[model samples]
Target chain A: MFVILVYDTAAERNPTVLMTCRRYLHRTQRSVFQGELTAAQYRELTSALSTAIDPEYDSIVTYTARSPGMIDSTTIGVHLGGPGDIL
Target chain B: MFVILVYDTAAERNPTVLMTCRRYLHRTQRSVFQGELTAAQYRELTSALSTAIDPEYDSIVTYTARSPGMIDSTTIGVHLGGPGDIL
Candidate 1:
């Protein structure tokens, strides 16, 4: 599944959550990551995230695109690293 | 269609692009916006974005979710505005 993961954690745990996500996905911007993953990888990611966040505090939203090119994206300003980075 | 729009514009035009997007979608973060847009709305947004950005420089990527709930999302930090807001 291709996913766009957006997260917001307490200030103290920001690094931990950010690092964990960076290990699995591309850090497009602060608290935002996106890339492809298999069901297993997704499960693993969710598991790690669940432990990193407090249910009553932090929030993470993941959008799973239906297909590879299903996402119609546009670029406006400076180019940061993106899907083009990998294959 | 449901879409997640991410953009990275030049430092100078950032505000213009951000405000344009905010008019059509929710500002999930600094440059990330997501919401449901009709085909017409999507076209309009693209048109506006194209005019707002310099293709040679800026980049905007729009991910259209297959279905309303097809996107399985999770929240971790502070819940800014979301799908639950208007609908």
Candidate 2:
């Protein structure tokens, strides 16, 4: 399975969380990681990484796909700005 | 593009935002929406939806996959529970 994590500036502070995440998942690029694992393994890896994260520094969004067909093809974004930002 | 909105109780309250989202995207199932749109269209839709959302009631996570190969294959989860929830 593949897991993608996108973090705002705050999330970058926790080195330990990033390190542990790197240990289990292959870092495909900066701030993005990927790997194929069974259900059990996926659970185990994410579970461990979550604890090491500091909630104050990070807001994480994880996306999991069992099959390529199930993937979402749109550009998903969260607007962290003011109400007027939406147009 | 496929966008999945998973709400942790609070996100369900904003009917207006949900309605707007439904109007633009095809609701594939409960809380999940799918459709194929150009980059400009996707941005416009999500931009509008973000404004009507109430921050206290919801935390939104959006995943956009342009191609099937970029999709993550792992089971992505967030443990909102206590620290020990990690195993």
DockQ (Cα-based) per candidate? 0.47, 0.15
| Model 1 lDDT per residue over B49-86, tens place | 98989888777777775556767655555666675543
Instruction: Please provide TM-scores, in order, for all candidate models, with all chains considered together.
Output: 0.71, 0.41
Give candidate 1's error at residue A70 in angstroms: 3.2
Q: Could you tell me the TM-score of chain B in model 2?
A: 0.57
* Regions of model 2 farther than 4 Å from truth: A9-13, A68-87, B3-36, B39-87
Chain B fold agreement for model 1, TM-score:
0.84
- Scored by Cα lDDT, where does model 1 land? 0.74
Tell me the tens digit of each residue's lDDT in model 1 across A1-86: 88788776779988888877877788665556788899899888888988988877777878776555766554445556675544
lDDT for each residue of candidate 2 in A1-87, tens digit (9 for 90 to 100): 655544322445557656666665654323444455677987777687666556554444445776534554222233233223212
Docking level for model 1: acceptable
Alpha carbon deviation, residue B86, candidate 1 (Å): 4.4
lDDT of 2 by residue, B3-85 (tens): 44432224455576567656655543234344445678777876776665665544444456664345432222332322232
